[model samples]
Target: MALLIPASFGNLAVSRRAHVSLTVSASANPRTFHRESVDWVKETASFFDQDKRPIMLFDGVCNLCNGGVKFVRDHDRNRRIRFEALQSEAGKRLLMRSGRAPDDISSVVLVEKDRSYTKSEAVLKIMEYIDLPFPQLAFFMQFVPLFARDSVYDNIANNRYAIFGWSESCEI
Candidate 1:
């Protein structure tokens, strides 16, 4: 199901698990394989235990992205994060509601009640929920201006496939 608000330039997609993958070269480089479209809605998807916490919408097949999730899951002793693929039904719903573009990221997103964050801002927000050492980074990230931070993030996003590699039709 694709939820698109054409007037608002908002589009979110939930692909049924077809297990099919599409391979494309990175726009930043032609030598890398970049696949980020995949089937992700599971047999069951619920928002239980997610009411007051941050919703972490991430890329499901990116090793780096998934690894980040694992790190958060391991450190989230308070269970403060709710995991969802941006390609899942619930995820697409929330992203659209939060006013974020669906296919516009290579990093995890942190969705709070009244706002959404991306790139470094989002990562720092997630860090706030993690343990000590991680939280420390949040404070440092604050020293960087938002524009600078976002610029760096964009560079990484544009180069993620070249640097990190991607599976065929990557999904999250």
Candidate 2:
């Protein structure tokens, strides 16, 4: 139960200048990741400094994921969290940058400063950035071992689509 899951895409070529320019960015067409197009995409779409805010990349089409984002957005009193649909170019790049598979949208991803968190760790770390009760709750939950926490997370994630449905396109 590591904080970051090893990226399925091994030895992905790193791009030096991919940056997000907007608070949130979403795209209709999911493109095949290409290293040479990174600079070109930066000029056209949203890419920015990861240091500006914590970016949460999630399953764009999953109803549960979208609902979760809405929940975070509502409770995030400081408004410090930024979001990018995992289907979006910005999200894909961020995933690659964090050494994650760009196509793997099974778990939520939280990219903050120079580190990345996934699964239960990502969810809990995100709670730390939210309002009073959540931060307190997250602090208490930290005492639980990672393996146990991630087991619950995986169960929910694996069954999310059946329980919550999915969308043809990303709405948030």
Candidate 3:
């Protein structure tokens, strides 16, 4: 049997064998849907250079989230990732385009050229994009069951503010 799931980026087909695939149409432009206005999309698309870098959306007020972004930046010597606070205009737009609530700041989001990933999946993708050791580590982590990985991610995300504390102001 096969299960069809509709996503903002594309249609996902999951088979009983546990195989899953995503198919995005050629005409579906992520930037067009993620931006409020066509003009803004055009301008920001050029300014951000989305083609060359993946966008990371993080909870700006969460201390742990800020630290994670900082860590990614420090390690990403090749500058493969671009960051935006989930509360920021650009981030909110992307969240909306991805069919997530703008106020849902619990999970880290990774937006690539044609698709988006959240929670543990997002973390793994970000690791793969970063240098050497991380890519090797991410490849190993991929062997872990998705549900198990995401469950752990959710537990930490749900208690992140209490455990790591939150800031009054949103930091980069």
State the C-alpha lDDT per candidate. 0.62, 0.71, 0.71
Estimate, for each residue in 73-125, the C-alpha lDDT of model 2 and write its tens digit.
99987798999987676776677666665666778999875577999999999
Q: Could you give candidate 3's per-residue lDDT for residues 78-101 as a string of tens digits?
A: 999999887765775566555565
* Regions of candidate 1 where Cα sits further than 4 Å from its true position: 1-50, 168-172
TM-score for each predicted model, relative to the true structure: 0.67, 0.73, 0.72
Stretches of candidate 2 off by over 4 Å are 1-51
The runs of at least 3 residues in candidate 3 whose Cα sits more than 4 Å from the true structure, single-residue gaps closed, are: 1-51
What's the candidate order when arranged by decreasing TM-score?
2, 3, 1
Q: Which window of 10 residues has the lowest lDDT sum in candidate 3?
A: 1-10
Residue 163 lDDT (model 1): 82
Query: Candidate 1: which pairs clash?
Result: 22-169, 35-170, 36-170, 60-172
Between candidates 1 and 3, the one scoring higher on TM-score is 3
Query: Please, what are the lDDT tens digits per residue for candidate 1 over residues 1-172?
Result: 4322333322224342324222221122322213232221111123433476778987765656767788899998889888887665555556554556444445667876556787889988999988888889889888999999889877876676678765544443
